[model samples]
Target: MSGFESNPFADPVDVNPFQDASITQATSGATENVGEFNPFAGTNSGKTIPISAASSQPAVLQTSMEQSAQENAAAGQASLIKQQEELERKAADLERREQELQTGMENNWPPLPSFSPVKPCFYQDFEEDIPEEYHRICKRMYYLWMCIATLFLNVLACLAYFTADSASGVDFGLAILWFVLFTPVSFICWYRPVYKAFRSDSSFSFFFFFFVFFFQVAVYVIQTVGIPRWGNSGWIAAISMIRVNLAVAVVMMVVAGFFTVNAILSVILLKMVHSKYRRTGASFTKAQQEFSSGVLTNRTVQTAATSAASAAAQGAFGRNQEN
Candidate 1:
């Protein structure tokens, strides 16, 4: 019993009967490895265990975020610069177009037939020669000139009709002369000057037109008054004819109405032209400068001036010799 019973002080022994030497050796080797293992030590195996580099992650992420922010900012700046440049280019193009429009372009006026012996003396295209702002007013001036010419023709016809009854051959003859003389002269003096004023914004032309057209307005008023024996079949003349012949009076009254219309139109056109002139940025000084320059540059004026100077110098020398 003593031999079979385990003693408390005695060493413990293996009780497994199926255990082999190889198994025992393996178990003992595993036990030895477990005893030598250190949890904190680095691996001895050729392959190392992977660890998360979480300590460096925030730094790398911060650096990448900074770089990305810089790149985004650069992209935004580049886009802004490009947009600014595009705006500048468009603005310059608009300015260039405005300048070209203001300066005007080539003209093709007085649209005449090629076979006609009479050549067009003046350029008269409203679209090509005049600015958009001045087109309506300029055309109105042209129409006024036409109306005036038509009125003159009507006056001539009325005078011829009056003369047929032996009323006054002088009036008829004078009407013809007035028609022929005034038609072309009025065109050259007032109409052409106003046209040129609008076409080139010429200060001199504006001044000339104002001067001549004022006198023209006065003439229209005179003609409207129908001063007897002055060639105009105006109110007085028409009223006087009523005593002689009713039909002649009626015809003369019609002519007088035409003259009245001409007078009214002249006054209205003068006001219109003046308003346009006010907006043209023209001045008396500028007109003077232009006149001076034009005169100085003219070959005819220069030649005449030179001849006058030579004559004066010769006269002065002769006077000096006499002295």
Candidate 2:
């Protein structure tokens, strides 16, 4: 026991001994410095220390960047969704308009034509057909054009008359006379006759106007040139220089042209008014009256008429059946 206890300096009995103090001191110094003067300390000594937050700076920065990216992605998605919704809304509006237009088209469907080899040249498509109102407008435009042309020519005739000479002198005196005469005649041919024909259906009026106006056009061309013995005194007198009242001739021509135009317009308006009067269904006057009377337009009268017609139709059908 004494021998075992007294071996202090007997080659250290192969026990592990301290090698170098430098490495140990360095490791210990490093640990001590980490505890006391750590590089990641938010507070030191008397101040509050934040260890985890200080160490986690790079990680937090990375996380912050990730969150910011996520927020941007969410905003982009929201914007995309809004755009899609707007597109869908626009599409729905277009669809609604399309459906409404289709309904309107179907409601105004024209009657189907019977199969014929020789089809008449008429409006045959949905949108290609011209309305009667459009035709009337075209007619009005043509009439206005004719009125303007006639007015200008009448002014010219007045000029020619104002500078009076032998009807043979200026080659235009006969033109002036013929235009003045034909102004009234043209009214009888085209405007006045059409007016009367439109006012009250006259079968001959159409035929007469058609033929007369055709002749009037020919006369217009011939009359524009110098007349060869053809005017009031022209038909039965020797060629002589008859000095006409220049101002009076022009005034008379203008007055005659205006009368012709006025006659045409008045007749057309009268016929239009009369025709509109016949279509009781489209009577604005009736509508206005009903509106002023504060009575909602009632279908009672229409229904009564329809019922009477239906009853008559039914009675006729029953009689035929019995027979």
Candidate 3:
């Protein structure tokens, strides 16, 4: 029975496949590789790609922003400097223009021939003296004065024709006197004042112009009415003469129409001058100051004052000697 259990399939000596040298060595090697493995380690090439820290990134970004801000400030400063240079150039141009005008004012007005007996008593230049804003109005005033002179001549002619038939030679003589009297006086009184006012922005001249021009407007109204024996061929005088001579009346009516036009223009110009005056910053106080200064600075006034002082000094010396 013992021999039957121990058959030929079973090895006589004890043997195990798991205990072989080659298999044992392979398992030991695999276990050692697993134990030495590390996921965070560098690759086998021995080179690494360095990553920047969060704190270091902020420093680099801040340096770039500071450089951009500096560039913007430099640009702004350059713009301001350019604007200042432009303003200075404009100021220089204005000053040059003012100097040219001052030099031009030395020449005489009317520019009459030197050999002529009549000399220019005033200086006038619209471009040199009058501001650009007041040039048109100043020229209009001059034209108005010329029209007034022409109207006076027309009135004289009408009166001379009226005197040929009517017994009233007085009207013709008075017309001649008015032509001679008012032509020069009106030029000096109102026209010159307004011219000087616009030229120099003189408050005193402005006030004088206003005063004289008011009377001038009143004269225009009276002349338009054509009072009898007043040298004016006004509406009433023209209508009355229609009974005797239609031709003479027609001439007189034309003169009356011209006078009416003059009156209307005078009122309009008065308002215009007042509006200009308001813009000039003129006032009563400034006018008074200018008048006082002008009087004090006058050569005649200074001479008179010197003479009076000398006379008083002599008189006081005489009184002291007598005492």
Candidate 4:
């Protein structure tokens, strides 16, 4: 009788609300059961059932994805660590190689000792220690030093002569004394001073050494002249001693030659030093300026002045008190 009733005469049409309702209820109940089901839930035998493909497929895929991501992250971290370690090792190797090369280069030159019994005053490995610009001048100074040493040997040779002739023991003793006195004195006074002057471009030291060394050059000349009765083999003794004994003559001649060589070298080196000093634009005026500056800036001078001023102040105070 209602619109929901089935029409069988005109057109075959069914309208069954209860049937549709029952179908919907059945579907909803099945969905509820599926949602309530747990794969890890205990069974009658206390064992969990395996999850159905429909429920577990997404979880399995998600777990596999997470595990893959973690593995990739771990692999990336390991690779970065390896790269960092390799870079550090390479840097260390490079630094070690550089040090080895430096050591090898340094080994090429002869090393000088800090102290020596004979040559105790100055020690410098010219090629390795001095600046390139000063090498020529320093070499000249070293040659001069060697010449002084040779001069000592000449004195020893003269001493040997006097040892053979006991009557001339005075000359031998004097020769020995000269060797002892002159060797260290010349080195410390003239040679070392000139070395420092040229090396430092100092005008005052250069002039001071010049005046002292001029006297040294004069002594060399007098020795080369070879006056008789002296320990040195002047030209007079060198030729005359040859007739007495061939060995004595040879020693005297050698000594004479050493003196001549020393004289010539000293003059040459002096000229060279003068030229260098001039090239540096150093002059007497500059030397005076340096000396004045040195005296003005001296600690002792300043201290003395301070004491004098304080004493004067105290004296004035005493006089004022008396007044």
TM-scores of all predicted structures: 0.62, 0.24, 0.62, 0.54
Question: For residues 169-194, what per-residue lDDT tens digits would candidate 2 score against the true structure?
Answer: 33345446555666555654665444
Per-residue lDDT of model 3, residues 205-312, tens digit only: 999998998998898888778887777777887887887778887888888888888889888888898899999999999999999987885789999999999999
**Top candidate by lDDT:** 3
Weakest ten-residue segment in model 4 by summed lDDT: 105-114
lDDT of predicted model 3:
0.82
lDDT of 1 by residue, 1-323 (tens): 88878788765974675487888899899999999988867655555545667567889999999999999999999999999999979977996896696556433345578797766666567777799999998888888888766456556645655665575766777777778888888889999888888888999999999999999889888888878767777888778877777887888788888888888988988898888899889989989998998797678999999999999999999999999
- The deviation in Å at residue 12 for candidate 2 is 99
Report lDDT per candidate: 0.81, 0.51, 0.82, 0.75
Kindly indicate the candidate among 2 and 3 with the higher lDDT: 3
User: What residue pairs are clashing in model 3?
Assistant: none
Ranking by lDDT: 3, 1, 4, 2
Is 1 or 2 the stronger prediction by TM-score?
1
Candidate 1 — which pairs collide? none
CA deviation > 4 Å runs, candidate 4 = 1-131, 300-323
Better of 3 and 4 by lDDT: 3
RMSD of 4: 19.9
Ranking by TM-score: 3, 1, 4, 2
lDDT score, candidate 1, position 158? 59
